[model samples]
Target: MRLYTIETGFFKLDGGAMFGVVPKSLWQRTNPADERNLCTWTNRLLLIEDGNQLILVDTAIGDKQDEKFFSHYFLHGDATLDGSLAKYGFHRDDITDVILTHLHFDHCGGAIKRDGERLLPAFKNARFWSNEKHWEWAINPNPREKASFLRDNILPIQESGQLHFIKDGEPFSPNIDIRYAYGHTESMMLPQICYQGKTILYMADLLPSVGHIPLPYVMGYDVRPLTTMEERQHYWQEIVDNEYILFLEHDPINACCTLQHTEKGVRLKETFRLEDMFG
Candidate 1:
């Protein structure tokens, strides 16, 4: 199996929102907010190539939104979903599966696109995978998360007859195992993969970046921050004990980081591009 980092591009968000109650002095040193105090973050997706099965982990914020809607995020980057796929000699139609960690707009927006007056799955041939709990939560989103779960980007997958849900512990594919967490959102599925005798866990929103590895770095967006803290503790110990590679979804610079047992707590021990590990 081979994994590729599919960078969908970068966008800005209020640093205070991204870092929660963490003071500016601390987060600014790492992310360094702009004059407007908005920090840039990369919407990094993962692609898995195993024989004829080409599975995409998540789709970054799609381009189907209106200009006024996009003005809020300040999205910018040379990399695009189609361009990145073509760079690796593939196309949208070649994708067999799209495993969405959650239905948040920034994570699965690119899974569908606007075609004329109709909304449809961008990869017509792919079976879109999302867990049942997350699917139900997103479908009937509460007021707190309504803005993040756009109906246009979501309902289309189900209407297209391509949406499917996997059991929490069921294997999505031979190359990937499944783990579920509910702190960030309801039943967010994190894909844990076994390759080369080392595990790589996709830290969707539960741990968006290495900075979030700390227990208290929970995002303000999380529905249940305390539950998230427990989940993080469980995962962190497991990752360090097993030497797992953590794939970040919103890190501005680093693609993957590994954890180490620090004197104070578990912290980022090393950062490397996914390609660096392949070499």
Candidate 2:
């Protein structure tokens, strides 16, 4: 099995929103804010190459939104899905599965693309995987998260007849298992992979960055903040016990890290690039 960190691009978000109730003074030390109180974050995705299947974790924000819509988030960086895939000698067609962690625009936007005047599946041959509950929640989004679940990024896969869903607690691949959490969004599936003699958990929005290692540092966008605290407590314990790497999706600078017990509970131990671990 092989894993590649696919860099789609970087965008900005209000640091306060990303840090939840945590005060800007505290979070700014870790994720410094700009004049606009926005912090740049990486739209990092994961590509899993196991045997004959090439599964992509989350598709980063695609380039389909109009300039007015994109003006809100300052998108930067030269890395793109096509360029990253080509570097690995593959293309969108080579992806057999596109596992959306959730239907948030940043997480699933690249799953679809603009084709002439219509929206369509970006990966023509890939079976887009999103849990049934998440699919529904995204489609009928609540007022708070409605802005983030753009219909253009979703709807296309189902319309194209390429959408699929895995049962909760089900295994996604031989080496990967699904763990469901409701704090970030209903049925947010975090992929637990047994790779290189260690367990790695995709941090998704449940834990967006190493700075979010603190249990109370939940994102304000989460529908259930209290549930997030409980989930983080349990997840951090397991992370420390198993010495698992937390694969961050939005951390601008760091890619992966392990945790250890701290005076304040479990906390980030070491940060490293993905390739450094196995190289």
Candidate 3:
């Protein structure tokens, strides 16, 4: 099995929103903010190459949104979903499975594309995967998260008859297991992948960056901040115990990291690029 890091570009978000309840004085040290207090973040996706199945985890914000809608996020960078796939000598059509961590625009936007007036699946041949629980929550989103669950990024998959649901705790692939977390959004599935005698947990908003390893660094965007805290506590233990390599999704610089049980609590031990480990 081979894993590839797919760079879909970077965007800016309010640092205060990214680090919930945490003071800017603290979080800014790790994720420095701009003049407007917006921190730059990468929309990093993961590609799994195993046998004939090429599974992609989370599509970054696609280029379908109008200029007015995009101006708020400050989407800047040269990396794109299609370009990144081509970098690996692959294409959107080559993907057999597209696993959406959640229905958030940043994570699933690239799953669909705007074709003139109609929205369509970006990966024509890939079976898009999203859990039924999340699919329902996103479609009928609450006022707080309604903005993140853009219909243009989600509805087309089901409309195209290529959408499938993976049950919680089920194996999505021979070496990949699904684990659900409810804090970030209802039933956000994090893929636990086994590769080369090690396990790598795809940190899909669960732990957005190494800076978020601390228990109190939960994101303000989470629907249930306390639930997020509890989930982090539980997962951090497993992460430290198993020495799992955390594949960060939004970290602009670091791609993967490991944790150590420090006197205070679990903290980042080391950060490295994915190729450094897989190569």
Where in model 3 is the C-alpha error above 4 Å?
A: none
Worst 10 residues of 3 by lDDT: 167-176
Candidate 3 TM-score, C-alpha based: 0.99
Per-prediction count of colliding residue pairs?
0, 0, 0
All candidates' TM-scores? 0.98, 0.98, 0.99
- In model 2, which regions exceed 4 Å deviation? none
**Pairs of residues at least 3 apart in sequence or in different chains that clash in candidate 2:** none
Residue 132 error, candidate 2, Å: 1.1
lDDT of 3 by residue, 157-177 (tens): 999999999987679978999
In the range 139-201, model 2's lDDT, one tens digit per residue, is 999999899888888888899999999998679988999898899899998999899898889
Measured with C-alpha atoms, the lDDT of residue 232 in candidate 1 is 92
Q: lDDT, candidate 1, residue 60?
A: 91
